[model samples]
Target: MAETEESTGPPATLIDPIEMSKLDTKFREEIHSMPNGEELSACFACSTCTAACPIANIWKYKPHQLIRMILLGMRDEVLSSDEIWLCLTCFQCQERCPQKVRVTDIFFDCKNLAAEEGKVPPNIVGLGKELLEKGQLYTVTADWEREDMGLEPDVPGLSVDGLRNILKETRTSKLVDGDK
Candidate 1:
């Protein structure tokens, strides 16, 4: 009997055969127009980005795989993926990339593209709404708790209205208002 070696590539689920219809030949160029985007094509699939990623362990598609997908012009799949949204943006991947691929920044571009398509999770949208309205995340201290701690009910010298005003003219405003 002849002996055969096991498949050395990534698991079958991580890589599917390419379909011409799913590719966007221009998607790579679209990303290239964004900051730090030109480096994307330099990726050599060394998996260094994945190895340096702090949260890669939990990702169905690690940073390197995602970069490869981007290089392959898997636009729809890349934009709609949860992995793009889940990146911690800690720069670990980018810092360790031997090719200087700017992995983290490319992911940021991918996320912005996803948001433009209204693909953001509802909770993220809610958070943006809360910030736009209140100029902060959820309340940092309860009124009653502040009073109990010998502090004023509200944080002194802190006003969110000014911040809110500036944000009103930003893209966040359009996004929160359900505009593309």
Candidate 2:
């Protein structure tokens, strides 16, 4: 009979029970109340979402782990984490979720809440500024590219004034302007 080799490393560390009273119980409830966030509790941490995510390799908190954190009521951690904004909104995780957890939608809600708290990343803030100022995220395409593609060089006009009015009426206006 072959004998098993003795362990060379330190003894296994044991985990103590989490103190339930210390958990932020309201955080999960608040998330559940948001639109498309009602199904957050259905996540079982199967890691399927993480496996399906194309950019999970770059994420500090994987999709499954983000859901787990939200379920665990780590509100400040989740809201402040750049991982929430790192999502590409591709909906791959949402499509792959066995429980249909709407992972991308939940991230959108988290982002909105984070933006309200002035926790958004600088690049995102820049994008918001551009949208509010120009009514578009990108500048008009180059004339050479349009001609190469057999398209008109000049695109139709946009309602910049209307867009500005809409932006001014929305919470995003305050967020973009740093009015908090």
Candidate 3:
């Protein structure tokens, strides 16, 4: 018996289809446990969701690809991908999905899973740390832009005590230092 390039089947000694259902089952677990797992099984691989996604144009794998990967159980690649974090959470894909797949929600789930698994990229980690420290997701806009827009230099109706209480109740106080 000789193995040829044209051999389309596994070797006779290989007793199990090691790359089959087991992989699907395992990855399916990750997908189902994701934030909106209900939609994970419904994807039909249509590119409509991807086509409607603003961020998909810039992504290495569009929304549908990410969903397909989850369906196929490609956990490591999905978890480590920058595409997961790059999602803007705009929900455009969700709205356009003919299957009603919760595309945006699933991306959120993947991001959470990646964070839980400590697989977040360094840039995201640093940004999260900064948000936690500053209690703001982004730095203040340029002073000139604010002045040009005639906006008040200070935030409206926000006080340190009010913000502290809200953050504490939301379990995000840990992101700030010297807050009780």
Candidate 4:
């Protein structure tokens, strides 16, 4: 006779509980070591940070989720999320956070972690390259804007080469390389 249903006690698991616990402990220690991460522990989950973030409206995962993920030591999820890249760095959320959590700085930290792991999105990498090479993110002509304003076009306008050289000197060019 063939047996039916109810055989396994529980499904097999890939994650090791002990390893996960260790990682959580390490992450908490690292967060506490940061200049302002102690503020992270004060979050009351009011979600005001998310509400104040302009980019949060369009994000698949909002700021609050990122904070929760950090608290839970979900490193892979936080590092690989597109929401971190989408942050405008406007500091609106940080300004509005009742807990005084440095949301913008945390996003910067997450972005740096993702970049170190080579997980940055291709489009963003490309834009960084363009900015590095051209010394400008947009092609809007200053003269054209001046003309629209009914003002005399300024002479000795922005020099792309000079800007590019400055960026190179500042070592910002490395930010463009996708392989980095």
Candidate 5:
């Protein structure tokens, strides 16, 4: 028989095994310490949370996978991933979790951490800016439109100064000022 190279999948030499020792094992502990993150360690990789998420189909990492990554100490990967920022805070995941894990809240903590590291998405920053500047996410109705609808043009007892002051005193001010 002629000499031939037989394929047995890819050669083992081409694959690099992950070195577990290098992972930041303390990451799970840090998450658990955060408020509403206390239940993170209770997740058993159940897909219930993912199944309940309305946006999971579009997410690169499903809710269950994100929790698994956090448990595995994949801090940088989890923190920098767009999946963390994509969560809608709808609480469906949390509501469906078999372990009662606060999946949505944990994502909130991850977002806060990401924001602290200046990894926030531009749209979210813009929303914060809008809220700080206008005390509302959407524009108020104009007088003509309100009159046409037989409604008051101005909201009753609505105020923006209080909201602006609150934002100014919190980290949101820094976000609005482009500090992060």
Candidate 6:
């Protein structure tokens, strides 16, 4: 007797039916009006963006799936989704999209909207705080990193104090401080 071979892939997921009442009908239009979001309608659900994404395998919803969700006006789900925060802003998906949908930029627009609503992840907010306070994301502990690149050991005196002062008056500082 021949035994059936076990499938190596993850189990199939059961998709829940979308409720018409929950969908924000104007959501797609809102995204469409944003810069670089106008071409969202061009996506034909080819999954090319998903194929081009380096981290697609780990995504809760792949690139094409996100576009479909936007087109379907899944406002609450899309806005509250942790998936948007997971994006790396790499242009591979955008570059490979036959529709030229500017996938990365569109995601950025979604991120902005989410940020406006204070849906940002804590890690990102912490990074923003670091940037606002230090004027640089990475620590400048040693000069070897610069020396390895054939550059001067010390970063020339451009006062981060002035930068922090100026940034305190900007929107970024408020976002970092959770002011809005």
Clashing pairs in 5: none
> Cα deviation in Å at residue 165, candidate 3?
7.7
TM-score for each predicted model, relative to the true structure: 0.81, 0.82, 0.72, 0.74, 0.85, 0.82
lDDT score of model 3?
0.73
- lDDT accuracy of residue 165 in candidate 1: 91
lDDT of each: 0.85, 0.84, 0.73, 0.77, 0.85, 0.84
Q: Is candidate 2 or candidate 3 better by TM-score?
A: 2
lDDT tens readout by residue for model 1, 29-73: 899889889887888999998889888899999999998888888
Candidate 5: Cα lDDT at 69: 86
Cα lDDT tens digits, model 5, 1-180, are: 111266546544654655677788998999999998888888888699989999999988888999998999988889989988888889998988888899999999999988888877888888888888887788677668789888887887888888879888898878767654
* Model 4: lowest-lDDT 10 consecutive positions: 1-10
Candidate 2 wrongly placed segments (more than 4 Å):
1-22, 149-152
lDDT of 2 by residue, 1-180 (tens): 111246666654565555566677788888999998888898888999999999999888888888988898888889999988989899999999999899999999999889888998988888888888888887786578888888776676645778877987887688878843
Error of 4 at 106 (Å): 0.8
Alpha-carbon lDDT of model 1: 0.85
User: What value does the lDDT take at residue 74 in candidate 2?
Assistant: 83
- What TM-score does prediction 5 earn? 0.85
Model 1 — TM-score against the truth? 0.81
Runs off by more than 4 Å, candidate 3: 1-24, 139-152, 160-180
List the pairs of residues colliding in candidate 3: 132-175
lDDT of 1 at 90: 97
Where is model 6 poorest over a 10-residue stretch in terms of lDDT? Answer: 1-10
Model 3 agreement with the true structure over 1-180: per-residue lDDT tens digits: 344467898756644433554454587776686568887788889888888888688889878888888888877788889998888888888888888888888888888777666676766656555555556665565487788899987677644555445655553434222232
- Go through the candidates in order and give the C-alpha RMSD of each one to the true structure: 7.1, 7.7, 5.8, 5.4, 5.7, 9.1
RMSD of candidate 5 to the truth, in angstroms, is 5.7
Model 1 residue 151 lDDT score? 90
Using lDDT as the yardstick, the better of models 1 and 4 is 1
